[model samples]
Target: MATEGIEAVFIETHNWGKSVKFFQGLGYQLEFETDHNSGQLRNGDGPTLFIAEVPADRETPLQLVLKVADADAFEPGDGVEVVTPFEDTHFGTRLATVRDPDGRLWNLQAPAEDRS
Candidate 1:
């Protein structure tokens, strides 16, 4: 399937407040936030940046998220491993995660169908 472009960059942070402040210092405007210790920010027309707090035991990595026409239809090239199967998210998006040969995570996302 064709890619729409980058949807967002996902960052796992142990210190959510500090990370959000750091981005805000860079002029990123807060888009929205959830009580689950996560939020979305944007700088002008650029791709959105998503920050979420992760467990201290978990490794925090920057995730590059690609926007596709359909997340369920994504087919990874050779050497790419599926990390998370495509699923509908609570944020009204369908998404999946894959790891490249270098172990960098890539998230694929598509707008979920409106249930309302």
Candidate 2:
């Protein structure tokens, strides 16, 4: 499979409301929002998100999204928990997440950056 480019970064926030405001203060705009499990933001480039209501009970740290050439090359080890698998999204990309050895979460994505 061919790899794409960096798409976006998703930050799992315990409170999307405050996180959104914080990011907006940092010059990130609230591009879109939903009543459900997610929201989207932009910082003059692409979406750098602050998702709300991600349960604080999470066993991992903040979700850091990294744009990769191919998501298939990424595989989790024993310490890395695969919370989600790579799959097509409405946003036009394949995305996945895993907890690294240090309990840090990462969002590995395969998709081109949005120029819109």
Candidate 3:
């Protein structure tokens, strides 16, 4: 896999405003937010951070998302477990999830190709 680097870190927060404020206090400027209580932020040239409100019944884990050249072509090495298969996301990207040896979840994303 031709991995680029960390793309974004996803954080699930119970209080969206508080979380946004906390990151803002740390110098991350809000780039954009969606109606569903999710936003992307960045501090300088650092990796982007994505914060979203967790649903009542779902527990969202802190996922480290890595940028890859092609999500469909990524294969986990030995001892790495595939949690979710790569699929096209509604947000215009391909995403897959994997579990590390320590049980941490990692998200892999590939930007959508231009159909035009």
Whole-model lDDT per candidate: 0.87, 0.68, 0.86
How does model 2 score by TM-score? 0.58
- Candidate 1 ranges with C-alpha deviation above 4 Å: 72-85, 99-103
lDDT tens string, model 3, 15-91?
78999999999999999999999999999987899999987688867877899887667766778788988888998
Candidate 3 residue spans exceeding 4 A from truth: 55-60, 72-75
TM-score of each: 0.79, 0.58, 0.82
Ranked candidates, highest lDDT first: 1, 3, 2
Cα lDDT tens digits for candidate 1, 7-107:
89999999889999999999999999999899999999888999999999999999778997866666777777889878899788998888877887778
Instruction: For model 3, name the residue pairs that clash.
Output: none
Error of 2 at 92 (Å): 3.8
lDDT of 2 by residue, 1-116 (tens): 43244456656767768888888899988778888756888888764674656787863245556676756575555565787888777767777777777877677787643449
